[model samples]
Target chain A: EAGVVQSPRYKIIEKKQPVAFWCNPISGHNTLYWYLQNLGQGPELLIRYENEEAVDDSQLPKDRFSAERLKGVDSTLKIQPAELGDSAVYLCASSLGLSSDYQETQYFGPGTRLLVL
Target chain B: AQSVTQLDSQVPVFEEAPVELRCNYSSSVSVYLFWYVQYPNQGLQLLLKYLSGSTLVESINGFEAEFNKSQTSFHLRKPSVHISDTAEYFCAVSARGGDDKIIFGKGTRLHILP
Candidate 1:
């Protein structure tokens, strides 16, 4: 089976500009996650969706960042008025939804590298 | 809340030599541990995971990690490494309950020397 797929492998923008990243999770996966990874740092969770419902988004910066998974299969993460500090990698991952008996592993995408000047 | 710490930011090892990357986690409850590897320009791949088992897990590429609950450590070790092993490795953990949010450590970059 194919792994998670992300679009626009790389993007470059100036401060205050808007940028968006897209992701397509593996087949049959019901959970999707968006993470931000800065240089020399690990990826941090921004938001998580179970099917079409966002189950966790406490870490997301609502002022500038927003995400949606309309069909429960594809997701989009957007950052409006991007700041210089927003330059980093945006990674997407997916896994089977919550289950008490089984915990499926999450698979990741190549990630979109964003550079904001 | 849980957190992970990777002591080494980088590890340089000669080809065919053994290597060990240390990982420590802090959690109040039982959790799941994972080691993911990211090659250049590639996505993160699951190297191994420790849920509830014999405390030892091995990957297909000769890498192994032993979960030590007392020490709160899950260090990855490989008897011998190849050029293909050069990549970034991340250690992460998620609590057994809740939303299963995973916390990751600053990845360790493995460099294979000639």
Candidate 2:
């Protein structure tokens, strides 16, 4: 069984530039998530998708960050006009079920490391 | 809202020595707990979790965690660690019902010495 897949394992961009990260979750997984991890910090959820519906997105920065899970199989997280503080690893995770009472284990991708100059 | 806290930012121990990584959480309602480990330049992996029954949970790789409801803490421990155990450990918590969005703590870097 293949695990979660992400592209552009590493990205370097200047401040004020636009950057996007992509993620393809495991086959048959129904839940997908996007998380951000800064140096020395744990991953924080930016958005979550249950199929094509976004169940939660309160933590996402509306001004500069946007995410979409079209068709609910793959997801894209975008940060336009990036800032120096935005440099971090963008991790994507997936789970088989939507509820913790069910299949709660989350499998993560290699993550896209972003370095904003 | 739920939040997780990992007390130690880094822990260094010699090979074969026992180690413990402390974690605490705050929440008004019931929650599910998890421990994730990440190697250098890698993604996170599930170490263990505490859901409904069994306050004590063990991972296949010799790591274990006990959930303390009174103290609201879940600390990861290994009886004897190896150099391969070196990694970043994160503690996370999520609400029992509603949404399963997890809140993670600042990671703890575990370095196993030779």
Candidate 3:
């Protein structure tokens, strides 16, 4: 089976501009996650969606960051008025479900590297 | 709050040598531990994980990890490492009965010398 897929693997934009990253989760996966990975650091969860509903988004910056998963298969992460500090790798991951046994593993996409000048 | 710590930023080892990567986690409740590897320009991949039952878990490629409740540590080990083992390894943790939010460590870059 094909793994998770992401588009626009790399993106560059100036500060105050708007940027968006897209992701397609693996087939039959019910949980999708968006994470931000900065240089020399590990990934941090930005938001999580169970099916079409965003079950967790407390870590997302509401002022400038927004995300949505339509049809519970594809997801889009948008950052408006991007700042230099927002430059990082936006990663998308998916899992079979949220059960304790299922949360143990997740498949990750190649990720979109965003550079804000 | 839950957090993970990878004690080493980088580890250099010769081919066919034994290697160990240290990881420690802090959580008030029961936790699940995981190890992930990332290749050049590639996404993270699950190497191994420990949820319950046997405190020891092994990946297909000769890698193993032992979860020690006393030390609060889950360390990754390999009897013999190959050149292709060079990559960034991340340690992660999440609460057992809580939201499935995972927290990752800074990551350790394994450098295999020829």
For every candidate in turn, the CA RMSD to the true structure comes to 1.5, 1.5, 1.2
lDDT of 1 by residue, B7-94 (tens): 9999999999999999999999898899999999789988999988789999999999999999999999999999999999999998
Instruction: For each candidate, give its TM-score against the true structure.
Output: 0.96, 0.96, 0.97
Q: Lowest summed-lDDT stretch of 10 residues in model 3 chain A?
A: A96-105
| Model 3 misplacement above 4 A | A98-102
Models sorted by DockQ, best on top: 3, 2, 1
Per residue, candidate 2 scores C-alpha lDDT tens digits across B32-109 of 999999988778999999988999999999999999999999999999999999999999999887465689999999
Runs of candidate 1 with Cα error greater than 4 angstroms are: A98-103
lDDT of 2 at B10: 94
Candidate 3 CAPRI level: medium
Cα lDDT, model 3, residue A13: 98
Give DockQ per model, in order. Answer: 0.58, 0.61, 0.64
Q: Give the C-alpha lDDT of model 3.
A: 0.92
Question: How much is A98 displaced in model 3, in angstroms?
Answer: 5.0
TM-score of 1: 0.96
**Residue A115 displacement (Å), model 3:** 0.4
What is candidate 3's lDDT per residue for B1-114, written digit by digit as tens? 788999899999999999999999998889889999998878999999998899999999999999998899999999999999999999999888787589999999999999
